[model samples]
Target: MNLALKDIRHGLFRFVLTCFGLGLLMTVVLAMIGIYNGLVADALAIVKAPAADVWVVEAGTQGPFAEASSIPPDTRDAVARMPGVAAAGAITYQTLEASHAGRTLRVYAIGYELGRPGGPEQIAEGRGIATSHFELVADRKTGLLVGDTLRLGRDRYSVVGLVEDATNTGGDPAVYVTLADALSIQTKLDPAAARVQAARGAEPVKRPTVAAVIARMEPGADVGLLVATVRQWKHLGALTEAEQEELLLVSVVDKARRQIGLFLGILLTVSAVVIALIIYTMTMEKLKQIATLKLIGAPDRTIIGLIVQQALILGGSGWAIGLALILTVKDNFPRRVELEPFNAIVLAGIVFAVCLASSGLGVRAAMKVDPATALGG
Candidate 1:
């Protein structure tokens, strides 16, 4: 009773090959979606990890992520001493490549004060940083084990703990170091550069600097008051948690997000065009059979059903194959590719809608088949 199933069975091998090819395309489209989500997750990981009520940065600038903003290291102490501030910590972030096991690993170096708000909220393995220097809590995605020793500029560090899904906006794995260690790395110049600076009568690098200050408020503290206090400092600016997240998601990565959206759009358009072309070709290949069916008095709806059923089968098959492929290889990517079930479901539904839409070309062609052509044959 199902003409589509009969036709597919008649060319089972070709049909399956077609499905496989289409599956690969679907995988690419789905991967793009997953990648965009992963980018957001990575960019926000640091923003959310601190769980701070307010962020204080250089006045008139968005902190670390959007733009460079540095404050005096002692600002942490000053902010902590503020009226509404229960606790404050100075943190710094930068990207660096470190040698590990004969490979260079790109990592986001974070300097957090001990007993501070900037430590990761969750540890997936071992323990968090406890020592004042040369200890690290690294993201597991860095391919680091708990006991692995990593060498950063002028120092060797031991990985004490591992966190999951922690990365900078650029998708580099995050590594935590003590404020002192980070300060040394930041200020220590090449020996030659330091010698030249000294000869040039350059002032020695003063106290260490921090990228931003994270603060948590006392119970029922007025955030407006804290913001007002921070604003008055003349050298500091503050953003609430909501404002920080918005700034990162909207203002920071907006361009990259739009580019990814455009890429996804192009991919969808290509998919639609390919599906339409394949269906149109399949209908053309079966023109003689279609003409015979028309001569036998089959209705237009039956022919339409045939095209729709075939499209659904192709779409479903490709979706299944693509999902399996993506899941299998997602971990192999350098950056995180988070393929959530909900996202997959939504994509599958959209794919089906596209498949139906693409079948229109074939349906129209099939409907125009002439019975007289079959009689001539």
Candidate 2:
């Protein structure tokens, strides 16, 4: 007879209740892993959207995602004329809050020239922006739909298309418009600000500048050569796509990653402690039975097997429950929760190791129960 299974069946309700509680704890651990993955994904979304090989920005600054960067609008033309350059587009980025559908919507506005490399690669719904003046392609996360019009700055723009999962590092949904319209929206001051500027007799603001110029190189082109050529322009800095992604991971989300890792460590420690304590307590409650088995000449291995088996069942059941819960509710999270199969597999391995380690305490307690204890009590 399996002593562990028999004991668990004797207290099935309690065993299930304990597993439920541990399941909740495991849910939190899995969620943290997913949230960390989501943070990295969100931070790199915009940079990867354009699929450009080279990014040119104002000299002495990182690309637009990390810090402020503004280069001349004509930078695109200069880069396009360089050898090995297949295409180039000047793009601007800004974060703005606008009133929409009785709520304030925060969005990251992107300006790209028509017939350029910076536009959205595919439209999920409707059509791409065809007009230069007031059309937009918005991320579906912005709650925008085709034919919906929203006022931005001094003019109104109509949504012509929708894209999925397009967001900036700050998690704001992205909207795409023509370069001219973006410049117009960005430069036009509100009436109150305009009045203040008029009172000061400030000269009209110069034409709005672009955040960066992105270039796509021809197949088999020397990316290093193009980056070097852009860097020698005296007023421009260039980074390849890999360098830009590294900069973002190191600069933009490094602290968040560290924070999540710390939390995961803490949670795992707590889980080990809780499992050890639970097993120890269960062993203490069954000391007499263990003594009886010893008196009947049961071997030490049988007793050890009982403790280890119970711990594994508890941990394995809890982990399975937690995985199910997280998968069901992951999509409802405000920010993305990207859980991969590999992440789940790694967690399972960690939990298995913890279970084995935790059973040591119960094993120790069961071994100390003297065979005489069963004769006395």
Candidate 3:
């Protein structure tokens, strides 16, 4: 006769209700883990999109993503002429808000030269930008579609293509345009502003600048040598892809990672406390039955097994329910929720350890029940 199973069957309704509540709590814990993974992925999305071997930016600054960087638009030609350079492209980055279809859309605007290394790698729908000006390739998250024309600055641009998972570190969807169009959109003045400038007799704006120049090296080329060569130019700074990613993680999203980790720690501590309390309460409620078993000469191991078994069942059932709930609703989350297999496995292990540690309280209380208590009460 399994005393733990018999007891649970007797109070099946209460057991199910308790598991349901714990399942909700577990769902929150799993969601936090997924959210942290998503944050890291989102932070690195743009940096990884280009797949460049080296980044060239204004001297004395980190890459364009971390801080302001501007280089001459013609820097692409100079980098391309360097030995072992397979390709180079000038690119610019900016954030803009534009009104469209009765709503304001915020986007991260990217400018790249045609047939360059900085454009979207693949288009999920429609074709890539075919014209040098007034054409746009937008991320699907932006809610813009092919043939949809939106006015930006002094000119209008038509959405010619759509990409997936293209967003900046700030979670804004990305839009791509030719270098010429992006410069015009970014530097052009409104009619009123242009008139004021003319009245002041100010000279026309100088040629627009690019945020950075990205270069792809030939296969088996020495990346360190190229970086060093660019650094010696005095007006330019260079970083390999690995260094750029590290700078972004350390400078851009480091605080967010720390905050989420602290929150996860708090949640796990609370879960352990709640499980311990629940097991202790259940053990107290069955003290007389435990005493009866002791009077009938049941060994200490049997009583210990009963408490431990019940604790495991509660925790295991709750974790299973929570995993199901998270998987079903993860796609609906505003930001991505990336739940890898390793993350789930690690969480399961933590939960198992928590269950065992929590059962200690119940085991301690059950061991103290006097055999005489059964006869009296």
lDDT of 1 by residue, 2-50 (tens): 9999999999999999999999999998889889989998888779999
Clash pairs for candidate 2: none
lDDT of 3: 0.90
> 321-365, model 3: which lDDT tens digit per residue?
889999999878777678998988888888899999999999999
List clash counts for every candidate, in order.
Answer: 0, 0, 0
Cand. 3 TM to true fold:
0.95
Worst 10 residues of 2 by lDDT: 198-207
In Å, residue 272's CA in model 2 sits off its true spot by: 1.5
Looking at model 3, residue 120 earns an lDDT score of 93
What lDDT does the true structure give each of the candidates? 0.89, 0.92, 0.90
> Which is superior by TM-score, 2 or 3?
2
Q: lDDT by residue for model 2 over 83-165, one digit each (tens)?
A: 99999999999998899999999999999999998899999999998988899999998999899998877888999999988
In candidate 3, which residue pairs clash? none
lDDT of 1: 0.89
Candidate 3: worst-modelled 10 consecutive residues by lDDT: 198-207
Candidate 2 stretches with Cα past 4 Å from truth are none
| Residue 336 of model 2, lDDT score | 78
